[model samples]
Target chain A: MLGAATTPAEARAAFRGGAVRPTAGIAAGYVQCNLLSLPAADAFDFLLFAQRNPKPCPIIEVLEAGQLESEVMPGGDIRRDVPAYRVFRDGELVDEVADVSEVWRDDLVSFLIGCSFTFESALLDAGVPVAHIDQGRNVPMYRTNVPTRPAGRFSGPLVVSMRPMPAAQVADAVRITSRYPSVHGAPVHVGDPAAIGIEDISRPDFGEAVEIAEGEIPVFWGCGVTPQAAVMASKPEFAVSHAPGHMLITDLKDSDFQVP
Target chain B: MLGAATTPAEARAAFRGGAVRPTAGIAAGYVQCNLLSLPAADAFDFLLFAQRNPKPCPIIEVLEAGQLESEVMPGGDIRRDVPAYRVFRDGELVDEVADVSEVWRDDLVSFLIGCSFTFESALLDAGVPVAHIDQGRNVPMYRTNVPTRPAGRFSGPLVVSMRPMPAAQVADAVRITSRYPSVHGAPVHVGDPAAIGIEDISRPDFGEAVEIAEGEIPVFWGCGVTPQAAVMASKPEFAVSHAPGHMLITDLKDSDFQVP
Candidate 1:
């Protein structure tokens, strides 16, 4: 197993070599992105969907058809960069593969979207404690009643990640995260669970729940899972996405997403 | 003539009533946009181009194929919303009409992009003196060597608008405009005009030139005319855009585009 001390290149090589199993916190200070791959016929709509919902789908880079390697991240192979990929047929998960080389097609278009991990670093830097990092658990995520802007056949409710922060540091959290719009910008909602239709904050739709201390407010941010929910709702004939928590590490620095 | 006192609804109503004139400073506080209408076949490429060059082309709303009215701005007819429309055929200027009702087709896709007027309000609010607004001249613009990120069938050098500001106020000007990313955002280049390929700032490629006073720097922001230049360069089968300064006044407020 590759440890957290490995360089991004070494980490990617390990993943390609079937040594790294999941990329939760392997390479620090680098960007880890969610992947969405679809056919050319659905590319325009998916692109438009991301454009309309930038908060949930902040695009880091888009790979045009027939291009496997990202121009921004040279030597990174789209087919083998990540630890795992999930193949979906009509929105149903059919297979989980270590490599997607055989299923790769000329018509495939890829999108790299910003992940919440970018802002989690900012939170930690600002002295705000992250519950999941301390407990070695997944960050809580939930499907909300918030409706995303419909584009073509893609239309669904928004998905959000939850983090319990002390009320005193909520403002600082907002300020720091707002600087990184390319990653899920600022908090969509703070202090309330019923408002966004998340009936149970302790029980999440995805990821393990973490402890919320007294005087801490539960904050919500647009999640990368949003596009996946949209894809599942749309029921496209074919699609591929990185398995949850198995992100493709990019060459981009966390500061690249910051606004001046 | 629609005056600054006129309401947005009244101005749009007047525009639809054959009031074929420029829409500059007509509806105060409302967002105005540059229009780009293209065949559905070319919609994907144009959308991608706008996505890549957001500073020059901040897409406010995109009316999909067969849609006549924008969902964001209700009851507004795109076919006759703007005061004037310039039609291009095979990349050449073919006609300038008051309305595109006769030429409108079902396969057409319309994109409404942010205009500088949205950010000019921000500059004025910040007490930055706008020379063109005071002297009653159109903001000077020029084509520069700064190349835009090209998408399918679209590629060209960037176009920028120049505003002369006292050296001391340049920072304030940048700080204010950076808030409105939907409206050309911040300055792409500040200082020496020749460095960005503008040999003479006095002689602009579009709009009347304004005099640069002593201790002033020529600050340049990406211009909305970039898409028009790219469309002309790409030589598409057919395209339609708003004539200079004749923009589509949207229901969105200038304050709405502000970051915080």
Candidate 2:
């Protein structure tokens, strides 16, 4: 198991060796990014979509067509670095694999987006408790009735992850998280599941749910899963993405994204 | 004669009527943008270029291929709303016109980039003196030896505008302007001009040079003109850009882009 002292290169090496696992706590202070690779034809559309909806799809870096290495993650082969990769065809899940070097195409343009792990660390650091980490479970996420500003063929409903906290600490969470706009900054909604189209607090559309303790209100934030949801709903001809919780560990420090 | 009471729509209306004038100080407190329109084939390349060099080319909004109306500035036509437009063919200035409606192409994609005018207003509001405004001359801009991160067919030297301020207020200017990253946020260099490769401070490559009074130092911030310079150097088949100092006034207020 990799811990706080693990470097990003070491983490990538471990993943390249077939370690299929979530990459949340590994290389603690460094940034982890959600990956989405698409054909050159669909690259512009996805880029526009992400640009129009920056809250949920904050782009860290975009690798040009046929480019494999990233400026932020130098000497890294994107095809085999992430622990897991999800292959999608016409928007349907075709296969899940540990490496995609054989299937990778020359015209594929990969985009690395900011993940919630960076901001989640800031929350925990600020004395604001995260329910999922405390309960040893995946974060609860929901799809809302809100429609994102669509670009080209990419369009979908807004997705959010919820963290239940004491009503008193909700503002602190908002203040701390808002400092990092690159990683789904600030909460979208603070209370009432129905307000954002969630039917039940106990059941989530994705990930495991934790109890909202007495006197705690549910705080909703824009989720990184939004781009993946768009891929499923819009059904692009081909796409490659990291499995949930499996991310490309980048060299940028968390403080590198913090705003004064 | 537009001033503090002017609305963006009215300012644009004046331009649409063949007022070929610079847009500085026209729509006070509202966001003004540098416009760059390119053929759809080159859109991705320039987008990548701007993404890589955000300090010089901070994008505010991107209009899809052949689309003109902006989300931030509704009821405004891209071709007719700007005070002046520059037509470029194979990297050469072919014409300067008041309206581009006749030459507009169905496949052209327009990019609205953040302008320093937004932050310049913030500096004034914060009690920092602007020498160019007081002298009634343009902010002096220079092309430096600093190379921007190249992307596709777009690449050029970083361009910066100089604003000389009292040494005591330099920190205040930096603190106030850094809040607006969308408008070329933060100074790229502080004191010595020779450190950044500028040979003579009085002779600027672009814009009129202003005198740096005693006890004042020239501070440099990334200029929005860098993208236009790239367009000139790369020699693409076709391109359209706003005339320098002639900008598109948008509906977004200056404070709309202010960070906490």
Q: Which runs of model 2 end up more than 4 angstroms from their true locations?
A: none
lDDT of 2 by residue, B61-155 (tens): 99998687877889888989998999999999999999999999999999999999999888988899999998999989999999999988998
lDDT of 1 at A213: 91
> By summed lDDT, which 10 consecutive residues of candidate 2 chain B come out lowest?
B64-73
lDDT of 2 at B117: 93
**TM-score list, all predictions:** 0.97, 0.98
Scored by TM-score, the top model is: 2
**Overall lDDT per candidate, in order of appearance:** 0.88, 0.91
| Cα RMSD for candidates in order | 1.4, 1.2
Chain B superposition TM-score per model: 0.98, 0.97
DockQ for every model, please.
Answer: 0.55, 0.67
Residue range B171-242, candidate 1, lDDT tens digits: 999999998888999999999999999998889999999988999998999999999999888989999899
